[model samples]
Target: MKAYLDLLQDVYDNGVGKDDRTGTGTRSVFGRQLRCNLSEGFPLLTTKKVFLRGIIHELLWFVRGDTNIKYLVDNNVGIWNEWPFQNYLNAQDLGNLEKHSCEWEERLDAFVIRIQKDQDFAAKWGELGPVYGKQWRNFSGIDQLDWVINEIKQNPTSRRLIVSAWNPAEIEEMAKAGLPPCHTLFQFYVSHDNKLSCQLYQRSADLFLGVPFNIASYALLTMMVAQVCDLELGDFVHTYGDVHIYNNHENQVLEQLSRAPKSLPTMSINPNVKSLFDFTFEDFELLNYQPESAIKAPVAV
Candidate 1:
């Protein structure tokens, strides 16, 4: 995890300041990469405790071809709550309220409550339009995920095992109710040693909050695909484009950096599951993940 911490520090020390679409400024860098060996240990951030349950549930939701926040909110994962809430507030002409204000937070909390309890309201307002799940499973009517899994099984030597979530045609629609995909495209490579490796090209990365989950999610995805394909675990290489730390998160980042990283955790997946799409939340467990307290940071919506 030193590599992860080093990148955070590098961005902090060397990045250029840039304004973002969310109206929050950032210290931005370009073209950084992180690689983690799956066999070594799960590359979850140790400097601060990450919500593994949310990551697992979100990834599972992606694989399930779901684009709604209801499943996440129902599972008590609030990571995607801010985006939809902001869009709703704006669409409802309530954008006059300051976004970071107490009233705004209260309204957002109420919004999540509606999404959690009212299925009709959730179906109407909670749809994150054609985000990762929709693009991964049905990018222009192609099931990229299923296709990639089958391709890995049938033609491991083929170099075209790629899945992309960046549909330029639908980018505007996605941004209307949700966010553009940051972890954009990924390709899988099979080594002669019967190991499966994945490399993700993320178009944009929120280093402090998003990158940790991106690393863990792709690593877990690789592990799941490898299990279903009967191959050994390999490396997950994350390639980023516009990677940045939000300006407001700088203090939290420093707090995180001040802490020493503990040992990596081992993720145990149910070996009996031979299908990637068949994985459920109970099928996975993170063992020995002792880390420091959580450092809260606001999402730049």
Candidate 2:
């Protein structure tokens, strides 16, 4: 949680203003990194209560190779909602126009329509369009998921259990559709002492609106991966490329930083669930979570 606070402080103190696609403008910085120790506690942001349940389920959905928003919607997780909503917005207004040519007014109209008619909207824009799931599960003739699992079991000390979401071909397709992968790539390293560490390299990050969810999601992923590989959890290191705070979210970020973090929460996993895929949402437990309040921030998509 302190890591999150520190990140906000850094952006507020030194970020430079920049024009962005959303027209909300942004205060942005180049490179920054945050580290959290799983052994210390779950890194769910305590200043403003982060939706831990949603984070866990979303990570699980990603690992399960699901690209549809059905699972996320069913679980009440709204992290991925903005992307598809924005996409749907772009689709309705642009109507197959050359990808990046949609006018801002049309995009806003699309957003309005999407929130009103979710099912139809999802049918059109819900697909992540060969984003993270496709890349992680099947990466250009290389099955990263299978490779990581097998490598973890066979050579648990290897540093090659990596999953990348930035597929060049897919990126071309998404760019044609007027979108690009944000949390672009991730790598996992294992120490000889059997400690599993994960580093996520995000090529684009919306700091105020997205980083909290990103932190919780990846930290949970690290914990789950460690459990499956039968190794101790190490650090969850997040590296960002273009981290920005949207103009509308500046006050919210400051409000969150003003609140002090509560005691760290403990996440308990079912011991009997030996395999990663065998565990369900019910098998996970959260204990001693006390947070101030939910700080609402609009997504800049």
Candidate 3:
């Protein structure tokens, strides 16, 4: 966790301030990386409370080959809520109201209500739309998960066990609709000694609001993959493109850096679950996670 704290502090001390899409401003840096050894313990942030349930459920959703927000919303996870909600707002007929007005909150609330009312809105808003699951499960004509499994069984030494989330065709569609993928790609490495390592390549990382969850999510994924492949968990590496500290979350990030981390939390996966795809949310446990108070930060959607 000191490693995590160091990265935040480094960004604050050296990052360049710039205006961003949300108009909330940002202190941004390029090409930062973080690595955690899963053999030690789960690399969940201990300086501030993180939403473990949300992380678990979101990972489960991705593994389930689900491309919908209903599972997330139903389970009280609000991580992906902003993207679909914002997309919905962008598509709405606002009737002379400014798009980025203070009424945005009210409009978003109404949009959620409308999604609950209209089946079509639910179908649209609930859909994940070319997110991690689609790419991991079915990337164009290539099934990444199957290929990874086959490689592990047959080769066990190939560096090609990679899952790419950045589809040029899908990016074109999302960009045309005014949405772009953030966490772009990921690659996995297998050691000769049968240690599984995962490296995530995030094209855009919202440090304050998104990085913590991203770290936990991918670490969990690495552990799961390692378990399925009967390999020891190695390092979870995070490679960022444009990592930014949101203006509103500056104080919170600073506070987190000042706090000393507690012991790393132990994540217990069901020993019987031998396949990554066979894991359910019930097959996981978090142990000895004691952290300080959560510092609420507004998401710049």
Candidate 4:
């Protein structure tokens, strides 16, 4: 994972400070790229332990065509609670939420519990409108995931194997929708040796908190496609625009860079899962994962 560490350092050294929508301020760079070889190892960050369970559940949820956070909360994944909680807080007309206060924290906790225990509340506030799953499964009444898989098998040499989450018509609505796609689009390439490779284009990347999960998520996606297509795994290329580290996480970023990365972990998937939509959270496992303690950092909403 030297590539990841290097990117972090690069942003620190050369990026310009700018204010963002979250008002966290960042030292950000534009247009950077990183590639991971799937044959080497799973590209999970070993410097700071990542929550693999959350990654697995979130990815599976997206594939299930679920736009609600109920599935994630039920499976103990709270990575996405901040946005919906913010929406609820806004509806309540709370002011000066620049930094979440003790009262705000308490209310957010109650709100999550309500989403878990109350189905109606979950339906009302837990849904991220037209987000990743909705876009992937029902973009303009077309299932891009199904189309891509069939294209890879039917015409391996075709260059049109792509799935996009960026709908221009919905961009204005997403501005206030509390959620938008960051990993915007991805394209697949098939090699002469029957290997499948994928490249993702992310519009805005949070280097410290989000990039690691993005890497693992897409790598797993590539592996699943390769498995169902009877092909070998190749590379996972990550391209970014406006990649930045939140100013508050400066210390944690340095701490992570100071630690030497351990050996990359391997992932095993159930061989019986023949379809992309058939994958469940239980069908995935991370093997030989030994890492340093997880570094705690605040997420920029």
Candidate 5:
């Protein structure tokens, strides 16, 4: 976790401030890499308590190719609530807005309630378009996840074991993808000793609020793949492009960095789950996750 802390400090010290798609500005840097050896520990952050439930749900959601947030919402995972809610708010006419004097905070609450209670509303508003899940499981009618898993098993040494979430065609049509994939692509490598290693190429990283979740999500993914393939856990290499800390989250970042990293936790998966797609939320568990405390920060939707 020191590597993650170093990244925060590095960005604050050496990064250049820049405007982003979200109005919140950022201190940005390009082309940085962080690696964690899985054998050492699970590599979950020890400085601040990460919401492991949300991380697990999001990864499972991606594996299922679920482009909707209804599953996440039902399971109490709200990490993705902002994007669809913003879209819904943008659709309302200004005349109606002025007449009602819309309270966005209240409407946001109602948005979740409606999604939970109304099936039609959930279908219409819960969808996140072709985000990670859609891209991972079915990219242009191809099952990339299944293909990659098979490649790892049959041809472990093949350099082509990759899953790409960045669909240029979908990005061009912005309506399909509300937001482009940030963790764009990931590649898997099998060493001679049958240890599985993964390297992720993230095009844009939200260092404060999102990077921690990204690291755990991909690390879990790597472990799951390795488990099904019957290989030893190796390194998780996280490479980034345009990693940045949002202006609003600077204080939280520093506060988190101030704390000393505790011992890394260990994660275990149900041995019965031999296939990657067969994993349910119950199949994964984090052990010894004592951390400092949760740091609160506003997300830049």
Candidate 6:
């Protein structure tokens, strides 16, 4: 986790000011990479208590090819709530409410309630429009996830094991309802000792709010893939593009950095679950994750 904090310090000290789609300014840098050893421990940030439940459920939702927020909201995950709620507001001509304002927060809360209680409304407005799930599972009718897993099993030495979420065709529709994929493409590699390594090329990164989850999510994904493919744990390499910290989250970044990082926690996954798609939320557990209180920050929507 020191590496994550170090990156934050680097960006905070050296990044340039840049404009973003959210109208929130950013301290931006071009390219950076973080590599973590899976054998050491899971890379869940110890500086702040991340929402492991949300991360797990969200990953599972992506694995199952669910494009709707219903699965998330139903399981008490609100990470994707703001996007579709904002989209709904825009469609109903309510886009003028200032983001993160008291009124906006109220409306967003109510909208999520509606999503949870009404299936029809959730199906219509909560769909994130073929973002990560669709691109990973069905990139133009190709099941990239299954294909990659099968490739890892069959051809351990193949360099073509990649899953991408940057579909240019539906990018506009995705932007209308939710965000296009920030962590765009990823590839898998197998070592001679049957160690599975993954490298993700993220086109956009919210360093303060999103990067931690991205690290843990991919680490866990690699672990699951290794288990299913009968391989050993390898490094999770995270390469970034346009990785930035929102100006509004600067103080929170400092707060998180001021705290000392604890030991990395171990993630225990049910060894019996060989199929990635069949993994349930209860099958994964985070052990020895003692961390400081969560540092809250506004997300750049």
RMSD of each: 0.9, 4.4, 2.4, 1.0, 2.4, 0.8
Tens-digit per-residue lDDT, 1-301, candidate 1: 9999999999999999999998899999999999999999999988898999999999999999999999999999999988888878888899778977899989988999999889899998999999999999999999999999999999999999999999999999999888889999999999999999999999999999999999999999999999999999999999999999999999998998899888999999999999889999999999999988899998887
Better of 5 and 6 by lDDT: 6
Q: Write down the RMSD of candidate 3 (Cα, Å).
A: 2.4
Candidate 3, residues 90-151, lDDT tens digits: the string is 56754345544779768766766665567777787667576677777888877788788778
List of clashing residue pairs for candidate 6: none
Prediction 1 TM-score vs. true: 0.98
Indicate the residue-level lDDT of 260 in model 6: 93
Q: Estimate the TM-score of every prediction.
A: 0.98, 0.86, 0.91, 0.98, 0.96, 0.98
Off by over 4 Å in 3: 95-119, 176-178
lDDT for residue 280 in candidate 1, whole number 0-100: 98
Number of the top lDDT candidate: 1
**Model 1 / residue 143 / CA error / Å:** 0.6
Q: Which parts of model 6 have CA positions greater than 4 angstroms off?
A: none
Candidate 5's TM-score = 0.96
Better of 4 and 5 by lDDT: 4
What's the true lDDT of residue 11 in model 2?
A: 90
TM-score between candidate 4 and the true structure: 0.98
For candidate 2, the 10 contiguous residues with the lowest summed lDDT are 94-103
- Residue-level lDDT for 35 in candidate 6: 95
Off by over 4 Å in 5: 94-102, 174-177
| Weakest 10 consecutive residues of candidate 3 by summed lDDT | 172-181
lDDT of 1: 0.94
Ten contiguous residues minimizing lDDT sum, candidate 5:
93-102
* Cα-based lDDT for every prediction: 0.94, 0.77, 0.81, 0.91, 0.89, 0.93
